[model samples]
Structure formats: structure tokens, C-alpha cells
Target: MKTFIASSPHVARVNRVDSIMLQVLLALVPGILAMIWFFGWGLLINILLAATFAVAAECTVILARGRSPLPAIADLSAVVTAVLFAISVPPILPWWMTLLGMLFAIVLVKQLYGGMGYNPFNPAMAAYVFLLVSYPVAMTNWLTPTMLAEHHLSFTESLRIILDGSLPQGLSWDAVTSATPLDEMRGKLDRDLTMDEIRQSPLWGAFGGRGWEWIAGWFLLGGLYLLWKRIITWHIPASLLSSLLVCATLFWAIEPQTHPFPAFHLFSGAAILGAFFIATDPVTACTTTRGQIIFGASIGALVYVIRTWGGYPDAIAFSVLLLNIAAPMIDHYTQPRVFGHGGKRG
Candidate 1:
């Protein structure tokens, strides 16, 4: 009998790009359902539209580059990017804008940067910033939650509004759309309203915005599932939330009247989602454990600074993009020593 010698240490490789991407899609379900529940059918429409556009764009780019589209498309990275961008945008965003964002995300940001692992910035976030910069009005026109809206448009009406920018005779944009919770808080703070005064509005919930925090909670639950699956480590999410909480607590502690509570920072907007899903992208984020901690913390701190004083209402996209650029350097500096490496590299 011949004995075959394998490598010294062999481990089963159970994770693949497709499997990982599928898990991410599954994790997003709870959050997506929550969003649809609160915001209505527009959310569902945006997601489908964006996903379709993303796959189309990915195919086009791959064919243009002389590659078979099937393999690239099978990975589902494009769909993940589409879902993230769609969920991040205003539910009432026009169909054209959704298509435009998907094109930019897949073609310009992802493929043009040499595809997938080579791209320095998170494609979803890059596309979001692109749309926000180019079409501020559409990007900011978030619909009022179902409970708060004076009138809820039917599916057909929502479709018409997104497709052709048409509204019923009796309704105006202001009647259906309202500022997001983050936007509302920023506006109120700009007007010198105290935190107590701002919380008096029906928009305010126990921690974050009415109906919004629940969505964040669902995302949090999904993130925890990801962590438990070992698909993602806790370093990024843990450090990110900790840094944001520390910053928010410090500021709010110093001036309770001016700063919102730490829980508000954690539960509002995309803080939890970004920490778990966006910032934890394997290709664009730091790989080393220590580097990931630093990378996540920097994003968290930047989010706090920008939300407090930057021009934008939420800073997750901006902060993530900024950190994505630095991830390579972070990995370089924080690389783990090779197994039997000397104490010094002399």
C-alpha cells in the first residue's frame, strides 16, 4: 500500500464567494422586510429595480472586457451591492436614478477599478455618494413612514411617482415625503432646539426615530447571526460600535442639551448596518484582525464627527469610503508575523 502525504495542517474550506454572498442576502431579509413594513411598497420596488439594473450592468461590463458574464454574475456581488444601495437610498427615488446608481456602482466603481478584490472603495457607498452629490433633492426625498404619513399612496400611485414623477391631483411631494429622522434631528439642532425639545415630536421613538429603530434592530439581529455563523468576525462591528458609543457618550455627557444620546447614535440611520455589512466587506476592508479593529474604529469616529458637523445628515457612506482607501495601508502595517518569523525583520 502506498501512503500519500498531504500538507501538514489541513482544514476544510466551507466558505465560498457565492455562499458568503447568499448568506449576506439572507441576513438582509429581516431588515428589508422591516423597511417595507414601515415605508411601503416603494422599498420593494427600489430593490428589484436596482438589482435588475446591477446584473445588467455587470453583464455589459464583463462582455465588453472579453470575459464570460456567467461566472462573474454567479458570485452575486453585484446583487449585494444593488441591495445595499437600494436600501440606502430614498424609497421614493426615481427609477432612472436607481438605474444610474446601479450603473455607476457596477460599471464605474466595481469593474473600472479592476473588479471585486481590486476596488479600494465600497461600490455601494461610492454609488450612494455619487447620487447624493449629483441629485440631492431626489436622494433626500425620503417618504414618511406609514404611521406618520397623512396619506398613504397605493402601489400604483407609488409606481407612478417613481416612474414618471407624477402625483395625484390632491397630493404634493411635501404631503407624502418627510425628512428622515437624522435629517429632522440635524434641522432641529441647527435651529437651536434642545434634544428634549426635538424628542417631543412624534417622529422620536424610545431610542431612535419612530419605526426606524425597529428596522435597525432587525439589522442588528441579522448582523449577530452573521457573527454567530463565523462568516464575519466581531472585530469590525465591535470596535465600530464601541467607538461610536464612546464618542456619542462623551459629547452627550459634556452637553446633554446639545448632543443626542449614545443609543441614538447606535440605533439611528445606518450605524448598525454600516458597521456590520458595509464596513465588513472582505475585499475593501482590512484583513488582519488588528487592522480591522482600527479600520472600524476610524469609521465610527468619522461618522460621529460628520453627523455632528458635516454637511451631510448621515456619514456612513463617506466615512466608509474614506476608510476603504486606507485599508491597504492598515493591512500593511498590521500584518501578522509569519509562523516561525524572527523577532526582527533585520
Candidate 2:
């Protein structure tokens, strides 16, 4: 047996890619369950389809690149990306659209930029924006929550809707679908309705959208679990929520009749989910401590701005993608001082 001297520093691998990705998947479970509970089986079906296709895409792309597919696909990154993308899209989105988004996310966004760590943008969000922009109607065709819904599609029915294009014979689209809470609020406000008047709808919960806010709370639970496990830090989620709250509070204080309360901003849309899960993506978000705060704060502010006045309803995907593009510059400027160095980089 030939025993050779080892390298200078023996680095042990504690958080392997597969392990960390698995933790993320586990953390998403509660939220996924809550989504299915509220939104019906379409959400689950889409997630399954996306995850399967995403894995296949990863294998095909890796083989084409002359790399071993197992090493990449086994890491679960593609699955995570698919899950995130699936959750973001309309539950009953056509099957081909999901496949297209997966291909764009895995082959183009992730692999085209040299895969995983090398990709500057978050593949899930980039694919989401691509789908949202290219097929606006399909992307926005969300189902009313189960509690508010007159009809809830079964698993098989949801599968048929996705694979095919419509509801059953007499089931018109209006029987089940409606505008999202944010969209509803914007439309009403544009008509010059006061927040008090808007709150008259049963769709309004204690603060946020009726069922949607609880889904966000379930996501918050998962995020807190991740924080407890040390899978993610507090800087991003804390700063993101705080900044959004400040903005919402300031605006609401200025015009109580027009602006919604602060809790609305925190619980609405993807605020809680994006704060903990999406914005904390290690590859695309800022790395330094101070940079992370700035990155999260910027995203939160943009969410408020875009949701309030922009064309789109929810702004997580747009805001996250925008900040991801600027993450490198943020890290560069906010780097901490070296141990033995002087003041700061400046």
C-alpha cells in the first residue's frame, strides 16, 4: 500500500449539495401541502410534472455536455428549481408550458451559464418570468381557493385540465377562477375605492387575502424550520420583511383610505415565501452579511413599488431576478474588512 502525504488543509464536506438540496425540499413540504389544500390538486400535479421533466432535462443536458448525468441530477437542484417554478405558476397551466419552462430553466438558464453555482440568475425565477411574459393568460389563470371556490377539481380532473385545455362540459372558466388578491385590490383602487370598501369582500381575511395569507403563514413555518436548522440565515428574511413593512406603513399612514395596512404587504402574494425561501438562494443572492441585508431590502422595496403600480400583480419573481442581476455588484461593495487589514475596502 502506498500512503501519500495529504494536502495542506483537510477540508471535510459537511453540507453536501445533495444534503442541502434535500433540506430545502423538506422545508418546502409544509408550504406545498398548504398550497394543495387551498388551491386543489392542480398545484400538486404541476409540481410532479415539473419535477419529472426537470430531472429528464437535467439528464439530457448533462449527457449532451459529455458529463455524467448522475452527479448533477442526483444533487436535487433541478427538482428544487422545478418545485419552486411549479408553485409560482398557475395551478392548471397547460402541460407543454410547464415542460417549456423546465427546459428553459434547466438547459438555458442553469446549464447555458455553466450550471448551478456558475449561473448568476436564479433559474426558477428566470423561467417563471419567461412563462409569465410569453403566456400571460395561461400563467395568470389561477383557481379560486378551496374555501372560496364553488367547485374544486379532483386529482384526475386537474390532470385532464392540464393535459387538455379546459374544464368539463358545463364547467366554464368563470365557475372556478378569479383575480388574485393583489390584482383585485389594484383593480378596485384604480376605480377609486377606499381600503375600507375593499375590505367588505369575503375574500379579505384578517389582514391579507383570505386563504392566501394562511398559505404564506405555512411557508413562514417552513422558513422558520430552515432557520432553526441553520440551513439559511436571518439577514435576508428579516431585512426583507422589515423593509416591506416600513414602506407599507409609511404609505398607509399617508393615505389610510387608499393604501392597505402593513400586514397586507407582509402576508399578501409571495412576500413571506420569497423572504425566506426564494430570496435566500445562495447562488444568486448577495454573499456578505451587509450585502445580504441590502439585497433583501432592495427586493422588498421593489416588491412594494411593482405591486402597487406596475403592470404585474405579484412582484417576487421580477424583484428577485432584478436584484440577482445586481448581486455581484452588491457583494463587491459590501465586503467585510479583512482580519488584519485596515478600515474597509474603501
Candidate 3:
């Protein structure tokens, strides 16, 4: 064997797009499992339908462009987008809605913009926001955690609901679906209830609503895995979580009765997932070290501000998308110095 010594480290083949996407899917397993544990089979069904439609849409578009779809399909970007969008919506969302979102994600948001690396917006979040805007009722029809659910839906029942968008005669929508934790917090806080009063409901557990906090922990675990694997650097996630924690602590300290504890902010909604997976998207997020910090900080701050006073309960998609639109500007101002240069490009 020939000796191949070099000062620089060798780039591992595992960094290929398909391999990286596979690693991401593997990282999502624990969190996805936890979600299924709490919410039931609807999430799984949603994943399957979204993946199917995403692949189909992507393939159709590639063929329309006079290209073979297999190579692109093997990269698994469409599946990643599908999973992200699927998990963001209600598990009981109708099949047609899933198809629409996938088409918007794969064809419109992604391929139309010149596909994967060339796309400026995160396709998943864009499709999610689109569906949320166009169909708010279906988008927000979240099921309460099974521990606190009035009725535990069977897999067949969940499948039927997603496929047909109907419930059994005796089963009312109000009986099966419940407001998400963020929704609960917003609704109760808007009604002038103290944080303590809101915490007393069976809907709550340690730091957040029942089951949600633990799901955040699992996602955090997955994020750590990604960091350890070197698939992602720590700059974005570290800054994002730190900024969010600081904001949460400051506000909670000022008014404990009105604001939630820092832990609650960290553990509830999509904070953990967004910080690690969504906000750190390679294409849409900042590139330079300083730019990444600023990008993450902005997202974290926006999430808190919007969730507190803006129309949405959770603001990850909105915040990330807004920052995505501004990423080029951020990088322009925060570029690292060149070896012989004293300052960044003007």
C-alpha cells in the first residue's frame, strides 16, 4: 500500500449528502419514537404518506426537467423535508393535505429554486408555513399526549382519520384532539391566569406539558449525537439555545407570574428540534463562524418574542424562514478575515 500522509485531515466518505441524510434520519429515531409513544400512530402514518408524495412529486419534476430521478431520490433530501413537515403538523392531518404540502416542498420550494443546495429557504419549513397559513384548522389539530388524552386512538382509527378526515359518530373532534402545550400556555396566559394556575392542569408535567419535555430531551440527545459525529458544528445550536435561555431567564425573573420558567421555554414546543435540526440547515443558515452565532441568536430571540406576543404559539418556522431570507446579508457583514487581509470584504 502506498503511504498517503498529509498535514490536513482526510475527508471521510460518510460526509456524502446521502450518508449525511441517512445519519440525520438515524438521529431522528429516538425523538420520533418518543413522539409516537406520546401521540400514537398518526405521526407514523403522516410520515409514510408525506414520504411517498414527496418522492413522487420530486420524481415527476425531475422527469419534467429531462433528468433521471434515481440519483436525486437516493440523496434522500425529499424524505427529510417530508419528515420535517409531517412532524410539524397534526398527525391526523388529511392525506390530501400531506400531498399538497409535499408538492409545495419538493417541487415548488426546492426543485423550482434549482434543487437542494441551491434552495435558499428550508423547503420543510416553507411548506409547513404554507399549509399552516392556508389551512389553520387542520394544521393545528394536535392530539394531546396520550398520558393526558381523553381517548387513546388505535392505529387503525388514526389511519382512518388521516385517510378520510372523519371521526366515528360518537367521537367528537373536541374529544379526540387537544390544544398543543404552546397553545394551552398562550390561551391561558391570554385569559390572565397565573403561570402557577396553568401548571396545575393535568396537561402539565415537570417543566412543560406532559410528554413534550421528554421529547425535547430526546431531540437534544440526537443533537448531541450529530455534534459528536461532526455532522454539525456547535456554533449554531450553542448560540441558539444560549440566547433563548438568557431571554427566557430575564423575562421570567422579572415577572414569574406572567412568564414561564426558562426550563419551560427550553422544553416546550419545537425549541430543541428547531435549534439543532431546522435552524442549522446548511443551505439556508449562515456560513461564517460569526454569522452563524448571529443567525442562531436572532432565531432564538425571534422565537421567544413571537411566541410571547406574535400570533403564533411556536415561532421556529417563521423565525428560521425570516433569517433564511436574511442569511446572505448576515454573512456579508460577518465574514472572517483572510490570511493576509486586515478586514472583511466591504
Candidate 4:
């Protein structure tokens, strides 16, 4: 009779790669629904297009390299990458632009660098920055939550809008497109407007700004769900948010007229999502708890510094990517020592 043997930690667990991916997909539902409700079927179109292209790109690369594509596609990481890419993009982006981003993300950022675990940067953020630089106009066409076309988009119509720049008469993306709250606030600050004056604008809300608080809320809910599912931990998320708050509190205390409040920073573009989903990517983030805290805090600090002083209104992507590059070094210095290890010699 044959017998099976196993290593230590003999307790069994139910977690699998597929299950984790499924949980992540489920967690994104709230945010995806929010996007569709606000931005219309254009969000759906982008998601479908991105998912399709990402799988295709991955398969093509695998085939060309004489490797098995089925396993990779089955793991669902490609789907997650596509979803992240789609969500980060403008809803009304032309289909070719979306395709280009997927190609870059899947082929270059992901596969060419030795596929998922080997890539240095987050594929989604890399594509986002690429699109932003390559097509500023299309990438910046963010639809305002309250502004939708009179006629609701059918699936085909939504596809048409994404594939072609044309929309039905009087159904301009222009009507829906508006500046994000962070961008608006940054613009006002650039114009020498006081923080109080800027906060009094129509864009301002109770905690965050107009049309932004709801989306942020949705992402936050999803993030909490992920945490509950044990797909992620609270260390990184808490550290990231706390660091941002600390920075914001310090700045606001020094000069309230110049710096926006902590609430505004917390509820603005990509803050919640970046803190949870993006920065907590296991492959890219620090593994140990201590390293995670340091990783999250560093990203939060970078986000504050970049958002306030750097050119971009939202620095989540840049901050996360920068910290990802530092994760290895963080882990190296912060890993716990073995029980019998002696103290370091002078």
C-alpha cells in the first residue's frame, strides 16, 4: 500500500489560487457596479475588451514561447490584470487604445519579463502610465457620475463608442466628462485659491468631493470584503491610510490654507484602492508583517509627497510602483531571524 507524506504545518487549509482569484473578482463587483451606474455601459465594454485582449495576448506569447497557455489562462490572474487596467482607464477610451494598453500590459510588462511572478512592476499601473502619456486626451476623459447620455447604451452601442470615437447625436462624452476631485482641487491650489475657497466649490462634499466619495466608498467596501476573506491583511491597508493621515495632518496643521484635509486625501482618487488592492499584491509587496508595514507606510508617504508637490493630482500608481521596486530591499532588511541565530557582530 502506498502512503502519503507531508511537511510541517500539518493542518489543512482550503485556500487555492483559483479561490483567491474568485474572491478578488467578487470583491471588485461593488466598484464595477458603481462604475457602470455612473459611467454607463462604457465600463462594461472596456472590461470585456481588456479581458479578451489580455487572454489573447497571454496565449499568443505562451504559444510563441512553446509553453502551455491553458494553465496560465485558467489561473485567472490575466483576468484580474485586465479588470484593473479597465477600471483605471477612462470609460470612453477608443477600442484601439484599450487594446494597446492590454498588449503592453500582457505582452511587455507581464510576459516578456518572465510572466506574472517575475515582473518588477505592476502590469496595470505600467499600462495606465503608458496610455496616459501616449494619449492624454482620451485617457483624461473621465465621465462625471451624474452626467450620462439621454439614451442608455446597448451592449453593441457601448462597443461602438469604445471602438469608434463617435457617439449618438447630443450624446457627447464631453457632457459626462469632468475633472476628478483631486484634479479640481489641485487646479484651484495652482491658481492661488485658498483651501477653504476650493472646498466651498460645487465639487466639495461632506468628507470628500462631489462624485468621488461614492466610488471611493464602493472600493472601500470591496477592500474590506477582501480583508474579511483573508485575501489580504490589515497591516498594509492600515499603515498606508495612517501614513497618509499623518502626513495630511502635519501639513494641514502647519498651513490649512495650502493643504487639503485628511478626509479629502483619504476619499479621493485611487487612495482606498491603492492602499488595499494595488499595494497588497503578494508577489510585489513585502511578505513579512514588519516589511508590509514599512511598505505601506512608504507608499502612503510617497503618495502624499507626490500628490502635493509632484505634477500628478493622484500619485497612487507612482507611489505603489516605486515601493514595489523597494520591496525586495525591505524584505531583506526586515525578515525575522531564526530562533538560534546569534546577535550581529560589531
Candidate 5:
């Protein structure tokens, strides 16, 4: 008898990317509901528009590459990306603009970089920055919270406004929408208003603002669920929020009128969302625990610096993308000691 031996390749498996992405989508439910309660159906239309375009664009790009489109689109990554992009955008963006943003995210940002795991940047954030730079007026037209704003539009009217870029009588949605809390604060500071003066406005609420704080709270809940599920580590979130608090407190102590409160900075704009979701993106973020903390802290510090002195009122996208560039170096330097090995290098 002759014995023949051959080495077999090792294959390791876990849940598919689709399942993880689906889990993220599920976690967004509370935040989505809160947005609808405050912002109305405009966000719904934006989600649908961005999601549809994302899936279509991904499929189309995959097919162009002679790959299976179904598998790529089925992974639900496109869905998550679309939702993130949609939520980051102003509720009143014209349908065509929304579509263009989705296409840029799905094609240029994701596919052009060889798709999901290989992309160096968070696709939705990149798309958001693109839209913001190109369409500043449209991007900043955040709607007034339902509780505070006088008029609210129906779902049908929202759909019409999003698709056509105008309400009845040729007025643009921008005319009715309210300024974001960050915008309001920056503007008031420029006009030499103190923090007390800014807070006295109906625009600011306890902790954060009328709609902004609730949205941030809802997203924080979602992030906690993700933590409970073990989908993400706590290091990133802790570092990001802690950095923000320290920076905010230091500045507020120096001059109260020049800086907003720490709580307000923590809850306003995309601070919580970026810390919990966007900055934690495994592909674009650091892999090791220490590295993740450093990456997150870098993002938090940049966000504060930019918001205080840079051109934009909210700096989450810029911060995240900037840190994404340094993630590789962060991972290299912060590599943990190998288990059970002597406390020294090989």
C-alpha cells in the first residue's frame, strides 16, 4: 500500500458581513424613529432615495467589474452606508442632489477603492463632505424641531419638496428650515453674544437642544446596544467622548462667552453618532484597543479645534477622515504583546 499526503488550506468562518451590517441597521431604529418624530417625513424620503441609489449603484458597479452584484448588494453594507449618508444630510436636499451623493458614496468611495473592507475612508462621511463643500446652502438647512417650529409638512408635502426643491408658491424649503444648534452658536458668538444669550433662545434646550439632544440620546442608546451585542469595543466611544469633554471644559473655563458648555458639545450635531458609529468603523479605524482609543481621541480633538476656528460649524466628517489616514500607523505602534510570550520583542 502506498501512502499519499497533501496539505489542506485552512479556512475560518464567522457570520457574514451582511449580518453585521444588518445588525447596525437594526440598531438605528430608535434614532430613526426619533428623527421622524422631530423632523417629519423629509428624512424618510432622504433615506429611501439614498438607499435606493446606493443599492443600484453598487450593483451596477459590481456587474461592470464582472462580479456577482447580488452578493455585494445583499451584504446590506450599501443599506447602512445609505442610511448614514441620508441622516447626515439636510432633510430638504433635492432628490437629484441626494442621488448624486449616493452615487459618489457607492461608486467612487466604496467601489473605486475595491469595495467595503478595502475602502480607506468611511464612504458615507466622504460623500457628506463632498456634498457640504459643493452645496453649503442646501446642506445647512436643517429643519426646526416639530415642537418648536410653527408649521410642519405632511409626508406627501415632504416628498414633493424633496423631489422638486420648492414648497408651494415657489418658496424654497431653506426659507422655512431652522439653523442647527452648532450654527446658531457660531453665529451668535460672531455677533458678540454670550453663551447665556445663546442659551436664552428657543433654539437651545436643556443639555443640548429641542431636537438635537433627543436624537443624540437615541443614538447613544443604539450604541449601547451595539456594545451589549459585542459588535464594537467601548474603548473608542469612551476615548472620543472623554476627549471632547476635556477639551470643551478647558475652553469653557478660559472664557465662558467664547465656548459652549461641555454637555452641549457632547450632544449637539453628530458628536455622539460619530463617536459611536462613524469613527468605530473597523475597516477605516484602528484594530487594536489602544490604537482605537488614540484614533478616537484624535478625532475628538480635531472636531473641537475645527468647530472653534475652522470654516465648518460641525467637524465630524473631517475629523473621522483625517484620523482614518493615520489608522495604519496607530495600529502598528500600539500592537499588544503576544499572549504567553516573554515581555520582549522577537
Candidate 6:
């Protein structure tokens, strides 16, 4: 009998891409359910449409690349991208727009970069920025939360509005849609309204906006669950939130009348979501622990700056994309020293 030699230090790995992606999908459930509860069936519609489009796009790209499509599709990365894009967009976004964003995410952002692990930017966020720039008006047309709406749209009505751009009788786009909480705050501040006066609006909640705060809370819960399961490390999220809090607190202290509180920053828009899901992408984000902290802190600070002074109301997508470009450099400088090495080498 001949003995065959193999590579040294063989180890069994338990985690798979599909399994990790499945957990991420599970983690999104709390936030998704909360959105549907407050926003209505339009969210569900966008999710279904985006997911379908993403899978189709991924398959098309994989086949064109002369690779087996089923295995790539099975990893569920495209599905995750689709869901993230869906949740980020306005719930009432048109079906065609959703499809277009998914196609951009799956094909141009993901596949064109040589599939999942090769992309430098978060695909969903890149798609979001693309749509936002290309269709600013449509992207900003967020529907009023169900509680705030004068008339709650039924499933069929929401579907019609999304698919056909048809408003129900006696309803107009102005009547149904409103600025997001972040946008409302920016607009109010631009108009020189005091924070207290702005908070008096029904849209304002204990920390962030009424329905939006709770949705962010659910995302936080899901993030914590991921942390508990060891699906993600604490470096990125902790650093991101802490840096954001610090920036918000410093600005708020400087001008309490003009700036919202730190808690408001945490719970408003996509701060929490970006910290956990978008900023923590295994491929695009920094791999070293210290580098992750640096990367996340930069993103957090940029998010605050952009939200306060940049052109956009929510800055997560822009912040993450910017930091994605820096992650490799961050990792290079922050590489950990090898054990028992005599000294650090350049």
C-alpha cells in the first residue's frame, strides 16, 4: 500500500457562503417585518421584484462568464444584495426602477468585478447611489408611514402605484408621500427651524422619526443577534457607532439648536443598517481587526459629515463606498505582527 501525502495542517471549516448568507437573510427579517408593518405592502413588493431581478441578472452574468450558474446563485449573495437594495429604497419605488437597480447591482457592480469576493464596493449601495443620482425625484418620493398617511393604501392599491404609477382615486403623490425623517430634519434646519419645533411634528419620535426609529431598533436587534452568533466581529459595529456618536455629540454640543442629538443620529436613516450589514461586508471591508476599526470609524465620521453638510440626506451609501476604496490601504498599514517575529518589518 502506498501512502499519499497532503498539505500540512489540514482543518475542517464549518461555515459556507450559503450558510452565512442564509443567516444574514434571517437577520434581516426583524427589520423587514418592521418596515412592512409601518410602510405597508409596497416594501414586500419591492423586495420580491428586486430579488427576482437580481437572481435573473446573476444567472445571466454567470452564464455569460462561462461558469455554472446554479452554484453561484446558490451562494445567495445576489439575493442578499437585492434585499439590501430593496430595503434601502423607498417602499413605493416603481417596479422598473427596482429591476434596474438590481440589474446594476448584480451585473455591473458584482459580476463585472469578477463576482462576489472581487467587488471593491458594496453592490447594493452602489446600485442605490446609481439610482439616486439617475432618478433623484423618484428616489426621494418616499411614502408616508402607514400611521402618518391620511389614507392607508391597500395591497392592490400599493401594487398598482408601484407597477402602473397610478394613484388611487382622490389621492395624489403629494398627499401620499413625504420626506424621510433625515430629509425632514435637513429641510427644517435649512429653514432655520429649532430642533424643538421640528420635534413637534408627528413624524418625530423619542429618538429618531416615529416609525423609522422602531425600524432601526429592529435592525439593531438583528445586528446584536449576528454578534451573538459570532457571524460578525464587534470591531466594525462598535467603532462605527461610537465614532458616529462622538461626532454627533460634538456638533450637537456646539449648536444644540441646529443639530440633533447623538441618539437621533444612531436611529435615523441607515446608520445602524450600514454599521452592521453594509460596512461590514467581508470582502470589501477591512479584514484586520485594527483596520476594521479604522475603516468603520472613518465611515462613521464621513456619514455624520455628509448627512450634516453634503448633498444627500442619508450618507451611508456614499460613506461605505468611499471607505470601500480605502479598506485595502487600511489593511496594509494595520497588519498584525506575526507571532514570535523578532521585529516588525515594513
For candidate 5, what is the lDDT? 0.89
> What's the TM for model 6?
0.95
The whole-model lDDT of each prediction reads 0.93, 0.92, 0.91, 0.86, 0.89, 0.93
Error of 1 at 178 (Å): 0.8
lDDT string for model 1 (10-97, tens) is 8876898888999999999999999999998889899999999999998999999899999889999999999999999998899999
Better of 2 and 3 by lDDT: 2
Off by over 4 Å in 3: 1-12, 343-346
- Model 4: residue 287 alpha-carbon error in angstroms: 1.0
TM-score of each: 0.95, 0.96, 0.95, 0.92, 0.93, 0.95
Task: Give candidate 4's error at residue 277 in angstroms.
Answer: 0.9
Off by over 4 Å in 1: 1-12, 339-346
Per-residue error (Å), model 2, residue 121: 0.6
Candidate 2's error at 72, in angstroms? 0.4
- Candidate 1 backbone collisions, by pair: none
Question: Model 4, range 104-175, lDDT digits (tens) per residue?
Answer: 989999898899788888888889988887887788787666542345665676677777766766777555
Off by over 4 Å in 5: 1-14, 169-175, 338-346
Provide the lowest-lDDT 10-residue window in model 1.
Answer: 337-346
Give the per-residue Cα lDDT of candidate 5 at 80: 93
Question: How well is each residue in 1-346 modelled by candidate 6, as lDDT tens digits?
Answer: 9999989658867678988899999999999999999988999999999999999999988898788999989999989999999999998899999988988888888888899799988999999999999999999998898889998888999999999999999888888999999999999999999999999999988999989999999999999988988889999999999999999999899999999988999998999999998898898999998999999999999999999999998999999999999999999999988886967687
lDDT of 3 at 166: 69
- True-vs-predicted CA distance for residue 220, candidate 1, Å: 0.4
The C-alpha local distance difference test score for the whole of candidate 6 amounts to 0.93
Candidate 6: clashing pairs of residues? none
The TM-score between candidate 3 and the true structure equals: 0.95
lDDT of 5 by residue, 301-340 (tens): 9999999999999999999999989999999999988888
Candidates ranked by TM-score, best first?
2, 6, 1, 3, 5, 4
How many pairs of residues in model 2 come into backbone collision? 0
